[model samples]
Target: MSNEKITIAKRIAKELKDGDVVNLGIGLPTLVANYLPDDVDIVIHSENGILGVDAAPDKSLVDKDLVNAGGSHVSTKHGACFFDSSISFGIIRGGHVDVAVLGALQVDKNGNLASHKVPGKMIPGMGGAMDLATGAKRIIIATLHTNNGSPKILNELTLPVTAINVVKTIVTEKAVIEVTPEGLLLKEIAADTTVEEVQSLTEAPLIVSPDLKSFDVAA
Candidate 1:
């Protein structure tokens, strides 16, 4: 993985509060598990029917039947429990998850998300993204700042929206942003990066926070 991905994961891990129940979406969002502080008591949920998820297990300990929502092998926490998808999604759609860290293809100024499919591309359907996006009490988008130099954050989504106006926070390699009723706010910038640099890669208008601070990735 690139340093950019690791940085995004580390920053997002800091957002998890004690006792929060979080659902980590597939792809980059899954990396957040590795960076979470051991002292923080948070339960990780996977839609495939595991709760209290821990980090990925070593290759030798991997179990084919025990995996996360993304189908990657993972170790279970001490109190972890297994159930069917019915119960898993019930926990999600019932508004029990405190936070959902999701990966996005595009996020608009309105905090809309587009991650399911690309136009004319083959996909395995939308999966549980729609439910998680709408059901979670808080949504945080964890993705790259850009896709091969093209801004993923835009004034408006160019693709089909996965969820409408549900995102609360966004963490990229270069910055941490908050979505509000007004617009996107720049909360923190990575060290050695500038507001101008972030803005240059973002299509939406960004309002810099008065109390903006440098993100300490090494922390």
Candidate 2:
């Protein structure tokens, strides 16, 4: 991954609280595990039926047979356990997950998610995205500011949605935007960027935080 992408993952990691049961969606969201704080002790749950997941293993130590929901190679923590998909979905549906970190294609001002499908492309099934988005106590969207110069955050969604009004926080490479009842709030800008730059790149109108600050985080 690039430095910006890694930085995005790092910023998302800060949102995780101790003892929170977090379900990380596929793609960039999967990288958050690599930068978790030493003091935080969130349990990583993979929808593919494993709990107590550890950080991404070194390439040499990765076990091909041990993977996350996205089919990415992963390592298990000391007490990691595995089970069938039915039980995995059961845990998710039972409201056992605290926070879910998901990647996005488009998120609207109203906090609706559209990560599953776009206009013209093939994809695997939704892969528990709906369940996680609805079941988790909180939902955080982790993504870059834009896709190939086009904004992914918008005033309204253009693609098919994954879930509606479920996102609580959005951590992108350029800014930390919170999806609130009033509107999408710009909480923090990146260290190297300005609020103007962030707004210029975003399609949705932003409600600037009263205590707005620049991101001081390190990847």
Candidate 3:
């Protein structure tokens, strides 16, 4: 898992396209902002009611009232707008967002995501996951392939679901998988990971790419 976090972050970042409206969920999903290419004109959305969000702010520039959904202070571009949560969800449910990057505790073979609550642990609320999961045109899940050395990409989710069949891609430290009609397809794997190793971690059957190749950080 060398540079595992960075690797996962970069993998999600690469999926962004120009002019895309994106909502980056708390935690790992937020890292995508730091990696957006200069040429891309993607706009960031914050469910707390901000649009055209900027990258992380410097400590000196942090504003108590200007924060992302994760509660971290964030800066905004010149044209960014602040609105009510109701309007924000309208934009989400109205299908205005082109993509949503989410972090999941578990994602099953069918693209069901469990991020709201993991049984047996009291935690923060689900936040905007429900709206973002079903509303966004595309859902990209950014997470570790496993937790506590156990696979999180499962045959069936153990926790309650946030969304069903909403995931378009799964980016992890070990591999990248896309949800296809046939099933989850193994698009790529980390340089040192083997197909057998990845297969062992995934509960769903993995279909290796015909030209299967190793994963690498974009230069």
Candidate 4:
């Protein structure tokens, strides 16, 4: 994985608290599982009918039938359970999940998310994302600051929206942003990144947090 992706994953991992039940979306969101602190105890839920997700297993230990939402082979934490998708989604739609970390194609200033569709690009289909977006108590976005130099954070969404006004926080390689009723707030910036660099890559105006601090992966 690229450093940018690892940085974003590690930053999002810090948001996971003890006793939290988190559903991780495919791609970068799945990487958050690897960075979760050793002291933190939380259940990792995969929509594909597994809970208590553990780290990726050694190749020799890989279980073909045991995979995450991204279809990557993974180990299970002690006491993990399995069920049908119906029951898994029931846990999600029932608002039992504490947090949902998702990826986005675009997230507008209003916290609207666009992740499933990319215009004419063929997609398998919107999977459990729509349900997770609305079902989770807290929604966090983990994505690149830009896509091929184009800002993913925008004043208005140009792609199909996954859920409107659902995202609470966004973690990118350059910064950590919070979406509030007022607007987007730049809460933290990467140690190597400058505030101006982050602003230049973001289409939406940012309100820099008074308590803004440099992002450290070790923290």
Candidate 5:
């Protein structure tokens, strides 16, 4: 792959608008902060306790108490504020976040997302994902086109759902798919990927834009 995680993150950062309050989920979601438009006043929120958080920190300056929910040390820009978990979740539940970018294990055709435990594997339970998905003005899922080369989008999710009909768009290495009442719409495809390649990985039928242009994620 082409360091797909970085490709997905860079594209997502470009989609953000100015002055948006964004909450980034643990892993890939956190990478968005590093690529956001420096000119835009985008404020990042972490579910654990930090709001207006900064990007990844230098390992030498790690602060145990300034970690995100994923246990990764986080820095902060000037004017960043700290609050309790209860307050952070309240912002999510109260719909204060403009966008929430989350990493998902699976996303169904109906825009339902499954990010928690699997039947055979134990993992961290859903913490603020449910709240962020349901309450954010926009929910963006960042994940690979596949897991171990197997599709992650399914006809029906095998795991418990975090939010139903809440995902607005999915950003993957190969394409950017929008969730609509009809089906997944192929909004854009990476420069190196073909429509056929995207179709091969999509569990549902994909709709191609008549004016679709080649996607250079870095462009």
Candidate 6:
């Protein structure tokens, strides 16, 4: 991973709290596990029926049968248990998860998320994103500020939305934004980016917080 992306993962990890049950989405969000605070105890939840999910194991310790919702190799923490999707979704829909860290294709000003599919592309479908977004106590999106030079954070989402008004915060390589009733709030700016640069790259208008944080890359 590039330093910018790794820095994004490290930033998101700080959002996790002790005793929290965090459900990590596929792709970039998966890296959050590697940077979690060592002093706290947090259980990782995988939709594929694994609880207490551990970081990716070293190749020597890889277990073919063990994996996360994304089908990537993973290890299990002590006391970890496995179950069927029924019980898994039940835990999600029953609101047992404290936070759902997701990656998004697009996030609009209103916090609508569109991550699962893109119009004509053949996708496995939305997976558990809909359930996690709706049921988790909090939702945080970890993604690049833009995609191939185009902004992913927008005033209006152009792709099919996975869920509406569910995202709580957006952690991008450039900034940290909070989704609120008023609008998308710029809570923090990247250490190397300026407010003008962030605004220029975003399609949505940002409400700069009075106590906005800067140099988040080192925080």
Q: How would you encode candidate 3's per-residue C-alpha lDDT over 127-200 as one tens digit per residue?
A: 78988999999999999898967999988888998888898899999999988878888999998789999999
Candidate 4, lDDT over the whole model? 0.92
**Candidate 4 ranges beyond 4 A from true positions:** none
Candidate 3, 36: how far from true, in Å? 1.7
Model 1 clashes, total count = 0
The worst-scoring run of ten residues by lDDT in candidate 3 lies at 118-127
Q: Quote the positional error of residue 163 for candidate 3 in Å.
A: 1.2
Give, for candidate 6, the lowest lDDT window spanning 10 residues: 210-219
lDDT (tens digit, per residue) of candidate 2 on 1-219: 988889899999888898889998877888897788999988999998998987668999988789888677878888889989999999888889999999888999999998887656846568799899878888899988899889999999998888889999999989999998899999999999998999999999999999998885772
Q: For residues 1-219, could you state the per-residue lDDT of candidate 4 as single tens digits? A: 898999999999999999899998888888887887899898999999998998889999998899888888999999999999999999999999999999999999999999899767857578998999989999999999999999999999998889989999999999999999999999999998899999999999999999999997844
Distance from true location, Cα of 109 in model 1, Å: 0.8
TM-score (C-alpha) between model 3 and the true structure: 0.94
Clashing pairs in 6: none
lDDT of each: 0.92, 0.89, 0.88, 0.92, 0.86, 0.91
TM-score per candidate, chains pooled = 0.95, 0.92, 0.94, 0.94, 0.92, 0.95
Give RMSD (Å) of candidate 1 vs. truth.
1.4
- Which has the better lDDT: candidate 2, or candidate 5? 2
Off by over 4 Å in 2: 56-65
Model with the higher lDDT, candidate 4 or 5: 4
Q: Write the per-residue lDDT of candidate 6 for residues 37-124, one digit (tens) a residue.
A: 8897889999999989987899999998998888889898899999999999999989999999999999999999998888788476
**Candidate 5 local lDDT, 156-195, one digit each (tens):** 8888888899999999989999899998888899999899
